[model samples]
Target chain A: MAEVKLTNVVKRYGSVEVVHGIDLEIAHNEFVVLVGPSGCGKSTTLRMIAGLEEISDGEIKIGETVVNNLPPRKRNISMVFQNYALYPHMTVSENLGFSLKIAGKSGAEISAAVANAAEILGLGDLLERTPAELSGGQRQRVAMGRAIVRHPDVFLFDEPLSNLDAKLRTQMRVEIKKLHQKIKTTIVYVTHDQVEAMTLADRIVIMKDGHIVQVGTPLDVFERPVDTFVAAFIGSPPMNLINGHIEADHVVFSDGNRLPVPPDFTGKLADGRQVVFGFRADVLMPKGHTLAESGVVTDLDLKIDFAEPLGSESILLSTLGGKEIQARMHNPRPVNEGEVLTCELHLEKCHIFDASSTKNLRE
Target chain B: MSKFSRAIRDHAVPLALIAPSILVILVVVLLPLMFSFYTSFTNYRLIRPDTLWDWIGLRNYQRLLADWDFWVAFGRTILFLTVALNLELLFGLGLALLVNKITWGQRTLRTIMMFPMMFSPILVGFQFKYVFNDTIGLVNNALQSLGLTEFAIPFLVDRWLAFFSISFAEIWMSTSIFAILILAGLFAMPKDPIEAARVDGCSNWQVFRHITLPFLMPFIFIAMTIRSLDVARAYDVVDVMTGGGPAQRTELLWTLIARTAYDDARMGRANAMAYASILLSIFFTWYFFRKLMDARKHLGAF
Candidate 1:
């Protein structure tokens, strides 16, 4: 296992900089996932670490060596591509043994390593099958097995589960997590799916527009997002953000709707500061349908436009200050359209952000 | 009967549409093929029209089977086909690999690469004829200027040199066909495998041998199958460059057959030899096609 350190890594395509001098350090044996939207430089960052793409400036270190100029093979890292990238002509055993063969390992060593990897992935029965004959999940397993056989310093995954169906993707996510645990190697995974990042990451690095926005543990980033983007991106139904301005202990919306400042930011903000009032759907619950009764709660009347029942709980679409907001209804009951209900806005769980900067003013 | 009529009625429009092509093939191809088969059994000569009806079954075949000159021409043709096809494949694969790496003006380069293939075989033959012409050719002139040769070397007249010159011309004209097909395969190949191979600790050469070449095998074989057919029926280039001459040094089956039919007025023997040479073409096509299928299977099912 090796700690990967990217010190001010910048990737440029001509004068247009794609990954703009982002720095990150991943600890040894850490399952660090780079999560972001498309064109967010997460994959680009992963590729740079893999040495598939050159870092335009700055340095990337696997262990202690500056691997910026080293080719991919010399970097002593393996990558699992999005489409599995198994050699189509080769059987599963051959695909697994290929790296060892290229390394000029003895035939007996190669077969032993291949067999060990196949056993790890439970691909023993599929040793003779080509990639075309295997199912999507099996191909993914072979791709992982190929990486495992090499025993690289770090494993780079570029959205490895993106091609599989949702069920298979989840199954493979667990498999990858188990693989990481069993092998105990540093992993730098890139995926657009925040759920995958949240589920699999020991630490999640959220990127946007080639810049890293936030880097924290799964629960850390989930509970304490740095900005409106992170706040919206990390959660399932997203945090509810409504535009407002502060006016002497109250947040006032355009429609003259008012709310007292959340308990955390009671006296920190000055008067007449334009702000964004944010809370997750979990924090805004129907009065009796709340999960916890310990937080500082405020009961407010709101009209439920519709309800989306998801078995045990339902998300009730409602309006707050002319902006559509969602509130949770735990142990949900069917609600009539346009029915007004009292919702408990948990002030302790809420956040206030500067309107223009979109930065969370939590500190 | 009703099912048969229904099937005919169901396919009536397509059958009608293709009827013209079938009729044309029947008249132009099948009829001539039948006539040639009939002519091969007779002692026919162009000079004696009445001799067309003189059936001499097995005589022409018997004479040809025993003819040392004919057998020599047959052997030369086989060797020419094998050498030309193999050389074309090698050159084509090399050219394709080189051109596949060119990213700047690749389309322009591909177009330029195909310039030789654009020229008709006869034009290519004539072009190479002057290029390799013994005394005043570009090859001899270049060699003389470079001090590679003491005097003018007879490229088209010397036995080995003549074979090399003819084979070189044919390869030049058709190697791009292989290159283009192989290039198309390169374009369609997924880049992920190569990247994976590199990340899997493969050198540039190893990546090419273990990944790129295997991926390009099916395309190479397809090019082989096509070029083998075009090369096995070799006539125009050798005829134009040396006329199978310098004492029958470069005589191929086609050249010998043409000379037999026209110069010696032996239509029956020529037709018999033509039919026999067709077996060679069929064999080459079949062999290359089998190789193509095998390569495709190696790459996994379609």
Candidate 2:
């Protein structure tokens, strides 16, 4: 296990810089996931950490060694690629033992290591089969087995479960979590899937446009997103952001309707200050289905445009202050399309952002 | 209706569609093949038309079994095919690897890589004939000027030198076929496994040997299959450069066959030799094709 440190790391392709100067530190055995949208430099950062891509500036340290100049092999890191990247020509045993064989281990030693990895991955029966003969889940297990045999200081996963089906992804996610628990290696996994990041990461690093926007626990980032970008990108259905301007104790909408500022930020703001109100679907439940009974509750009747039933809960798509927003309905029942239901807005969970800069006023 | 008639009627449209192709194959391929097989058993002479009908039976075959010169040519052809094909594969693989690394102006470099293959085999023969000429040739001149040799080398005249000179031209003409096909394999390769290997503590050479080369085996075998057939029945270059030689040192099957058939007008004997050469070519093609299939299966591509 190793703690990884990235100091002002930047990546550039010719004159075009993709990953801007970014700094991050991952603790020993910490499963830190770098989550962002596509082209957001999450994978680039992971590749830099893995020594697959050279950083343009600054340093990367793994444990006590500065690994900026080290090749991936010299750095003692193993990466599980998104595609599984299993050597199709080799049998499962050979694939698992490849690193040991490459390191010039004796035949007996190689076989032992191979057997151990196969046993760990429950691939004992599939050892003689090539990657082509295995199912998608089996191939993924082999990819992890390949990584496990190395027993490197850090394990790098580049969207490892993205290629699997949803059901497999979940099963593999649990297995990966279990693997982390067993091995306790520092893992730097990159993915655009927020669910993966939220579930897998010890600390989630939310990045945008090559910069780390927020780095905190999954709940920390989710409950308190650093900005509107994080607020939307971190949660499914995303946080709804409605624009308005502050006016004497109330925020006035474009339609001239007014809403009292959530008590925490009340009177601390100047009048006529433009702000964007943000709230997640969970925080804006219909009155009878309020998520938090203790939070400052503000009621508003919202005309439901559509209802998406998702087992026990349904996401109600509605218009608020002429802005389309999503709200969660607990113990959901079929309601008329145009029904105006009063939704309880948990003021403690609602966020207000400065419109011009889009930064959370709380920050 | 009869079963045969009903079968024909049932597949009438398909048979009618393929009729022209079948007719073309009968006229172009099958007829000539049958005629050659028939001539191999006869004392058929192109110069004396009456001898074309003479039934020599196994006389041509019996004479061929005893012909030391014909056997020598056959052995030399096999040697030439093995040496040329192997050397081409090695050089072609090296060239493809080096070219695959060239990231800038790769299209232009790939185009330049195919220059030798673009030349007709006849032209390559003539070009190398002049280049390796004992006097007033590029090789001798370059060697003399570079002070590597003091005298004319007699490249296309000496026994082994003549063999080398002919093989060189054939290899130069066709090595790019292997290079182009292997390069295609390199392009189609998923880069992930190579990266995974690198991270798996493998050196660059280890990655290539254990990963890249195995992946490229199918392409190499495919190229080998094609070039094996080409070199096994090699004629044009050997014919132009050595003409089966000063001492028959560089004599391949076709050159000896052509000389026997045309210069000596021994059509029956030449036909017998030609059949042997055709069988040799088929054997090489079949062998390499089998290897290719095995290699593909190893890669799980089948």
DockQ winner among the candidates? 1
Native-referenced Cα lDDT, model 2: 0.90
Put down candidate 1 lDDT per residue, A258-355, tens digits, no spaces.
99998889988999999999999988888889986797888889899999999999999988878999999999999999999999998988999888
lDDT of 1 by residue, B163-240 (tens): 999999998898889889989999989999999999999999999999999899888888887877787778998889
Write down the worst ten-residue block by lDDT for model 2 chain B.
B293-302
Q: Kindly list the per-residue Cα lDDT of model 2 for residues A197-268, writing each as its tens digit.
A: 999999999989999999999999998987899998988889999999999868888877677888879878
In angstroms, give how far residue A87 of model 1 lies from its true place.
Answer: 0.7
What pairs collide in candidate 1?
none
lDDT of each: 0.91, 0.90
Q: What C-alpha RMSD does candidate 2 show over the true interface residues after superposing them?
A: 1.7
Q: Which ten residues in a row have the lowest lDDT in candidate 1 chain B?
A: B293-302
Q: How accurate is candidate 1 locally (lDDT)?
A: 0.91
